[model samples]
Target: MRSPKDFFAPLALGAPEPLREVPFRPSRMIHFFDPSNERMRAKVPDIAPTVDVLLGNLEDAVSADSKDAARAGLIEVGKAWEPGHTQLWTRVNSLDSPWFLDDVWALCHEIGDKLDVIMVPKVEGPEDIHYVDRLLAQLEARVGLERPLLVHAILETARGVANVESICLASPRMQGLSLGPADLAADRRMKTTRVGGGHPGYLVRTDPVPDGDDDARTSFQQDLWHYTLARMVDACGTAGILPYYGPFGDIADPIGCEDQFRNAYLLGCVGAWSLHPSQIAIAKRVFSPEPAEVAWAQRVVTEMGDGTGAVMIDGKMQDDATVKQCRVVLQLARDLSAADPELAAAYGLETA
Candidate 1:
């Protein structure tokens, strides 16, 4: 194992030095699009400006026969694309897939400069991250990439969730972790077929109504992925990396999608996957701090001047801990506002 002093050192000769801290950006929506599809490829330029991160999907959705086309298309997109503030990311095939090596090889050599993060699917432990980290260093060295490409692991398999903490701390290149709900559910043998959102059957009933009719008892749907999401959040927080909620498959159910996204937002996820264009608005709305919430956080920070002493604000107690929480909200607003003028106005961050 490498010593603490060498942890941030380059893994390969001539490779760029590792980052000391994972930079925080406005990644409120990881909007996915298949690069192999001509129509989708056509829309990327238009879509890139609207989303915080545009991910070129070369796996799962792209059929085996189309994988080559998808990779080439992504390279083309990367070369032509101009991502002002939006990040360019891609979901390469799982490390075990036959196409993985070629995918990494070509992207690193051809478009390493444009690419931001590589989302590796089915990562089960720190070992997987170590392999990717070394490989990325070698490739970055070959291409003379000035900036190191970050890796984002998808928490898909049961094993991945089990080793989530280790995975987050595996490498300095670890940008974040995204909870892959559908694959994780399947791996965990969960009965629900839905990709995300609450399952009515996975909830608790109102004490069976005691002596009253059990049929009349109210049943409130609890979040199915709450425990896992919370655990992932804590792990990511401990590692100082970002956490994101994966895709919600039900595109038709906008309300349910919004609910799932909101739950993730409240539980510390910075963003979520947007499989459909319609989900973009939902993610943006849910992930961003509301105007009223920003106002409240601002009030708390203003009243708790220097963020040291205790004070009462609108009948609520404000302390050092609460001020830190308020700062988190305010900082997110400021980051989002930097890229979005309308959001700046909403959060009252607009300067004359």
Candidate 2:
């Protein structure tokens, strides 16, 4: 019954990580595709450029029977992906599963150089991350790879949420964490059927409909994932890693998906997962800072002159705090536009 945090405390104390700092990667839409599916697998090259990150999903989507096939398919597709334009990531089967070790072993040995990040799902605590970190280091050494592979944790289970801070601080290879709302809801046994969205039943009624028919009642729907999302954002921020919002399963309702992504973005998430092709655009749009916001931020930053003393901008206070917010928006805009040509065009960025 050792504490999860103590397991990695020695490394966290003062030791420098063997892994190099990963490149500044923008993952506005971590597009998910099943490598085992021929139709989806074939479209990687063409569709990859359209999204910031292309992920070969070998977890929940791939059945038990197709695990082997999915592993092979993922290697083939991952090795062939264009490195500079899009990040190649994979969601390996959970560590608790039988295939987990094999998936990590083969992926690192076979395609370690090609893969940018390996996402671990249902991460419960720091111990889970420490295990993968050790194994990945060994595999990377075995393959003679120059740069180590990065790890992304999916905070789905309730235990995972509770221990996210330790999980993010577990390793230098830790890239970020994404909210798996579907699994999270199920893990919590929440009374909702929809995936990654607000439930009408989980709402606030207006004084039980005063002076109106009992049946004629209305309530304002509230975001179900707000608390978890905010918590994840803060945890990731403290650890100097990124945070992302996972998919919204209702592919038919793009508006709802956009709203969910926007909520996350406003609350400090850098991006979200795009479950379907259509969601790619929504994620990109919602995650990127709007033109006006970016402009205002730039103005405030320029006026502040080194982000110090207070000033007035359009009758509003502009101080150290306001400058910091402005910098966040501007920095995010720069990152998103760097990888997205369409976004660069919209941002009026000139190319080389």
Candidate 3:
């Protein structure tokens, strides 16, 4: 392990200095597209502007036969597309995969300058990040890239979840963690086959009507991934990086998708994965603070003045703690509004 004094130093001789802080941008939805799919490749330009992060996926969904093509396609995307406000990222093959070496070497040497973050899948521990960190620094130094690329880990396995804090603190390049529910479920041997949302079987039922009518009892489905997501959020907060919700597979069920995204948002996730085009709007809507919420936060900030002492707003307490909460809401609104004009107008940021 490196000494604490050298933590922020570049691992490679001439690599750009490690970033002191992981920059927070508008990452409401990490929209995934299969780079090998011709139709998907054609729509990238149009989709790039609408989403906060566009990820070229080369892992999991990409078949073995198409992995090379997907990598090449992502390189092409990096070359051709100007991200503007949108960040460019890629999900490379896992560390254990045969394609891992080629994927990392090629992308870093080819379009390392354009890539913002490399999403490493199935990262089980800090050792995985340490490997990627050194490799990225070497590649960045060799390519003479001015900016060091960041690393994002996918919490896929039970082991990954167990070592999450170490993974987030592994390197200065550590950007964030995204909960990979499907693979995690398989690894932990969970019964459900769903991706990232709540399960009906995992629920709470109201007590029987005093044994009068058991059939009249109401049951509410509980969030299957809540505990894990909350833990991930806390780990991320402690590390000062970002936390995100991974894919919700039920694309046909947009309402359910929104509900799941909102749960993550409220739990402190900055964003989620959007596997389908329809889910893009759902993510944007769910992650952004509502207009009414923004208005309420604005009122609280105004009422609190210097964010000291206590006041009462609408019969609710407004103290330092509550003002801090209001600031969190307003800060998110401000960041999002800077990129989105419609949101700025809706949040009254245009005037502010």
Tell me the TM-score of each prediction against the true structure: 0.98, 0.92, 0.98
Candidate 1: where are CA atoms >4 Å away? 209-211
Per-residue alpha-carbon lDDT of candidate 2 for residues 89-116, written as tens digits (9 for 90 to 100): 9999999899998898889888888998
- For candidate 3, write residues 20-128 as lDDT tens digits: 9988899999999999998899999899999999999999999999999999999988899775899999999999999999999999999998999999999999999
Off by over 4 Å in 3: 209-211
Of 1 and 2, the candidate ahead on lDDT is: 1
Q: After superposition, how far is residue 106 of candidate 3 from its true place, in Å?
A: 0.4
Worst 10 residues of 2 by lDDT: 7-16
Each candidate: RMSD to true structure? 1.2, 3.4, 1.2
141-215 per-residue lDDT for model 1 (tens digits):
999999999999999899998999999999999999999988999999999999888887877787755578988
Model 3 lDDT at residue 124? 98
Better of 2 and 3 by lDDT: 3
